[model samples]
Target chain A: MDTVISAEDLTKKFGDFTAVDRISFEVFQGEIFGFLGANGAGKTTAMKMLTGLLRPTSGQAQVAGFDVYRQPELIKQHIGYMSQRFSLYEDLTVRENIEFYGGIYGLTFKEIRRKIPQLLHELGLLEVERQLVKSLPLGWKQRLAFSIALIHEPRIVFLDEPTGGVDPITRRQFWETIYQSAAMGVTIFVTTHYMDEAEYCHRVSMMAQGKIAALGPPKQLKQAFQAQSMDEIFLSIARGAK
Target chain B: MRTIFFILRKEFRQIFRHRVMLPMIFLMPIIQLLILSNAADFEVRNIYLHVVDRDLSPASRRLIGQFAASRHFVLTQTSFSAELGFRDLEANDADLVLEIPADFEKKLLRENEASLHLNVNAINATKAGLGQAYASAIIRDFNNNLRMEWLDMPDRQNPGRFDITHSFWFNPDLNYKAFMVPGILVMLVTLVGLFLAGINVVKEKEIGTIEQINVTPIHKSQFIVGKLLPFWIIANIELGMGLAFGKLVFHIPIAGSLWVVFGFAAIYLLVVLGMGLLISTVTETQQQSMFIAYFVLVVFIMMSGLFTPIESMPGWAQKVTWFNPIAYFVDVMRMVLLKGSGWYEIRQHVYAMLAMALAINTLAVLNYRKVGA
Candidate 1:
């Protein structure tokens, strides 16, 4: 398979402190790659560097065939990012939010108009299309946010803990959306603390103290560590780091 | 170009959708412009005077009559003892006390000179000073009249008197509202543009939406221009509303071309809104942005020559006004509204505003970063 993202010795330093230490990894085309870490393991920092939202202090990385240091703008054009906060304009209506994101990605007015009904129908939000986002339930908002993030049809989509605070059933439903997107040959790079979600990823990388502790498929990682489940694998790795 | 339009459209939708913000934007400025213009008037009138006449002669009676006849002075009390007038001054009932010496007419005819004690209460310095000036002017006019009558000149109307006629131009009646309404309109527009633009970006940061936008492919200049243009349009609309209120309610004449006022305003708002965006870039929280904008705006408005004339300010203080964007607008507003000044008369102010608009917007654009550190 073709490689969509590749990084070597990626590091980020703020003053005297290093946030993301020499972490290295590669993401393949149409593959669901899970980036796992405990809190403060520099997962978000690494994600930022990958999406061109931030620059690395000393590293060699490429995203969508563009260098992160020199061609960040080009990298930005090819990737979609959804933060842990579920980035959607809470004040705007659902239809307006879709059009806004579509427009920001260079879609014309006529194009946005054509895409709106289809997007609302796909998200099962046709009835509430005119409703303000702030009035929607958390589950609906999260689903809408995911759909809007993918509006530009970028080469890769990054989900930074896309399901942070939600019921299990909604989260399971959200995973189905990710699976479908991945099935359509859209690469998914996601970060999560939920072990069950990690098991769903084709491959998972566990980060500890700004370093990659493990990288492999869930079953392979479980068998190699002699653990029964992904939770035990993460706990053992975290304890070993300490 | 298309990206900027989308941003602008989104911003307009968000601003109008906010229920509380919508009314506050339109109503607050109109109400403030109406009420504050009346309060901002510097015209002082109705000085209360306590007169103590020691001389019961006709001369002393004539002087007291003159003070009573003057429109500015209200004869609050008449007393024989200076102590009574001094007591009135202490009670804040009287602004000034006029004491005529005994035999004041006898001394004026015999010695050709007579002095009277004018005791003034210096509390509320501006009122007291103005009261004293009005009192002195009445007395001088009375002296001139008495000289003409006493000399018994053949030509009573032309008694070698040099009449220095005071002519008030522009606002012939010296209406304070005409002067302050335009300045207030400028202030309201500046405030709306500055504070609104300042709070907008910081609010996005606080709510974590900025990260989503930063990851998009939009250019920084396109983003800044998009954010600024909507507010610029809203502020100008508010200015139009204020101008209508000034004209219909206050009857302030628009002496110059209305287009000139609008042209200056369009450019001036760029500087003010750019200041707001610049403050937002430096601050992480909306509260911090509010405080910083408040601090800078207070300094700017106070020195903007809105109520006080810049010519009356000290040389050093006046020099500092050259850098204040609000000062330029206030100057332009007054010149265009009251003096009917055309482009040629107000070109210096326009040039200053253009330079400020360029410098401030450029600095703000440079300071705003689409990427995180």
Candidate 2:
């Protein structure tokens, strides 16, 4: 397997508060690597470092063979990010939003024109392509945002609570989309609090209080903890931290 | 370059798609400019005056006639007692009271001069000052008329008279609309450009779309340029509309080259747009940016010499105007439109604006790093 992301003792501090401590992890290409943590467990900060949105206070990280400290711009070109807040322009039409992102990533006009129809078809949004994004339901908007993130065909896609506040059926479709992308050899580094979602990942890393407490496949973690389910394993880890 | 174009297209689409945006940007400001040009007039007329003529002589009667003859003062009441005339002023029935002394004609003949008591209501200081000036000017004219009547007498001592009449140059008619429309146009353009650009970036922060853009490979300069061009274009279009209204409706002359005026506007808008971006740097939401921009803009517009003359301001306030870009534009617009000032006359302003544009835009771009990206 190919290692697409590698971090060693990456840390971020805001004054005396450590948002993300000296943490180390490696995400391989074409695998669903779940980053599980409770709220304020430093998952978002760690992901920000990997996505090149933030600089580490200490230590190092390599995203798609580009150094986080030295070549954050190049790293940005190789990774796609979907933040938790549904990052599509609400006032713009769905097609315009996709075109905007495509242009930002330096896609040619001909390429953008060709990709729009196919993207809309994949998301089953061809009927509402011209509708304003604000008029769309939350689930459809989230899906469209995700599809736009992949327009550049980046090697790795970072999903930070991508399914938050989405309906359960759309959440299933969202997971199906993630699975399809992973099947096509695109690495998925996702952060979620749902233990059931963690069980679906090839491997999961649980963080507590700015530090990773456990790292392994869910079944292995469950067996090691002598727990019946991934939820119990996460509870035991969180309880041990407290 | 094509990337900037796409961003521009998206921005334009979003701005026009808002249902209230077209009217708010184009219609409302134009309406306000039309109304304010007529409403914010400096021409003060029809000041109410009360007359107290104790002499009851031909001199006093003719003096009262002169006050009634002029266009500025309206003789609202006539009384014999000074106390009665002052009571009219107190009741707000009169703006001023003019009292001729009982020995008015005798004093002028023996002493070559006579004094009259003129009391003015000092509330609403501008109107009071203007009303007092009008009264003094009429009195001065009456004194000259009496002096001319004495010159008609053969056996009279002819004194040398040095009379000064102010001929208002450039605007000979002293047209209030002509003086103010250009300044009002500058204010409207500043308001549109400043608020639109200021609110735009902070709105992205509030909605969290900035994070998505930060992860893209878009360069900082490219992003800044993309954000700037749309509002710049829209503001220019609004300027064109306002200029048309000023010319067609108000008949305000454009004495200098239109291109020269637009040339200054092009650079001045950079400073204003930079101010908008800078406001976004310290603010977290659209509401905070609005409050800060308005607070800053009120200070800027007041010192911009819109209605009041900057030359008359105090020393410290005048010094503050050196750092104000709106003051420069206000001065430029008036100089170009009213005085036929061309590029050579306004070159120093262009240089100053270029320096400000470079400084402010650099600071704004440096501060706007997607929250320290």
Candidate 3:
């Protein structure tokens, strides 16, 4: 498998405090890679570094085969980012949001017009395309945000706690969209607090205090720890830290 | 460029969706322009006067008659003594007191140099000054007629030869409304641009939408440009409406080219919008941004030489106004609309506005953060 993202000794600091310590990891193409951590455990900092939104204190990172430091714009062009706070314009309709994001990615009007219906249908948002985003349900808004992020057909999609505060049924539906994207050869890099969601990932990395304490496929990690499920394994590691 | 267009479209949508803000943004300025123009006139009218004529002579009566004949002043009451006139003034019933001493006609005939004491209320100095000038002119004319009758010479020293032809060059009548309408227009546009733009991005921060945009591939400069463009357009539209009202309703002449006024307005809008962006960048909440913007705008408007001449201010205050962009635009607008000044006459103000625009915009762009700090 081709490595889509590579980070070596990545660190980020604000003032004298380090947020993301010397961390290294790799994400391959077409796999659902899960990033799990407690709040303020440096998951956001690491994701920011990989997405080229932030500069690392002293590290080397490459995304989509482009250097994060010297080629951030190139990396930006190839990856999609959906933030924890849904980024869609609340005052605009779904179609307008799609066109806006597509335009920002340098997509032509003809291309955007052709892709709008198919994209809306795929996300099950065709009926509400004319409604303002603010009027939509939170679950629907999250789904629409994800769809807008991928409107440019980016190679790797980053979902930063995309399903936080969403109901289980909606989260399952959201994961189904992610699965569909992954099946279409799009790599998914997601962060979540839910251990059940981690089970769906091809591999999972649990961060503890700015360092990756555990990294393996969910099944392998469960067997290695002799746990019944990913949830039990996460509980054992969290208790060990305490 | 396409990104900027999208951002601008979204901004317009947001502005339209909010019901209360929409009327304030579009309708308030027009209403103020209509109502305040009439209230702001500097030409004093229906000025109440109290006359204390002790002489009881025909000449004294004629002098009082002259005051009554003038359209600007009205002889509202006749007092028996100066004390009564003072009482009238204290009661706010009279603005001026004309005191005629006893034996005034006899003294004038004998000495040809008899004087009349005139007391004027000096509070609200502008009205006081105008009243004094009008009363002095009437008294002088009455004296001239008395001199003519006493001398009995048809061709005595010619008053025409000594006349000072003081002509108001641009505004021939010195219409105060003509001057104020343009100035108030500048105030309205600057207030809207600075306050609205100031709170816009900060409101997003308070609501947590800023974080979403920060992570997008959109460049920082692009975002800043997009945010300010809608406000810039709105300000210009307001300017156009103000100019139209000035010409049609007030009959204030557009002495200079309309295009010249638009060009200066466009450059000045950038400076004001940059101030808004800078305020948004520093503030975290909408209310804080509004308060800060209001404070800065109050200082700018007062110091902009709109209500009062900058030259009349103390030297230090005048020096401070040199840094105010609104001062330059107000001067430019008045010069263009009233004085009929061309580009050559207004080049200095134009250059000053451009420089302020460039400096503030560069500072705003530099201070704007694309990612969370």
Question: Which candidate's DockQ is highest?
Answer: 1
Docking class of 1: high
lDDT string, candidate 1, B288-348, tens digits: 9999999998998899898667898999999999999999998899899889999999899
Note the Cα lDDT for every prediction shown. 0.90, 0.90, 0.88
Instruction: Give model 3's TM-score versus the native structure.
Output: 0.88
What's candidate 2's DockQ score? 0.71
**Candidate 3 residue runs with Cα over 4 Å from true position:** A219-242, B8-25, B46-65, B68-71, B74-121, B145-161, B203-207
Tell me which residue pairs clash in candidate 2.
Answer: none
Residue-level error in angstroms, candidate 1, position A66:
1.3
* Residue A138 shift from truth in candidate 1, angstroms: 0.8
What is the C-alpha lDDT profile of model 3 across B1-373, one tens digit per residue? 8777767777787788888888888799999999888887778888889999999999999999999999989889997799999998888888999999997998998888887888888876887899999999999999878878886745446656365679788888788888998999999999889998998889888877776666567788888888888889899999998889888999887888988899989999999999999999999999999999999989988999998889999999999998998899899999998888888999999888888999998898888876444
Q: Over the stretch A1-242, how does candidate 1's per-residue lDDT look in tens digits?
A: 99999999999998988888898999999999999988988899999999988889998999989999999998888998898985999999999999999999988888889889998998999999999899999988988888888898888999999999888999999999999999998999999989999999999999998889999999999999999999999999888878
What docking class should model 3 receive?
acceptable
From the highest lDDT down, the ranking of the candidates is 1, 2, 3
Model 1 chain B: lowest-lDDT 10 consecutive positions: B152-161
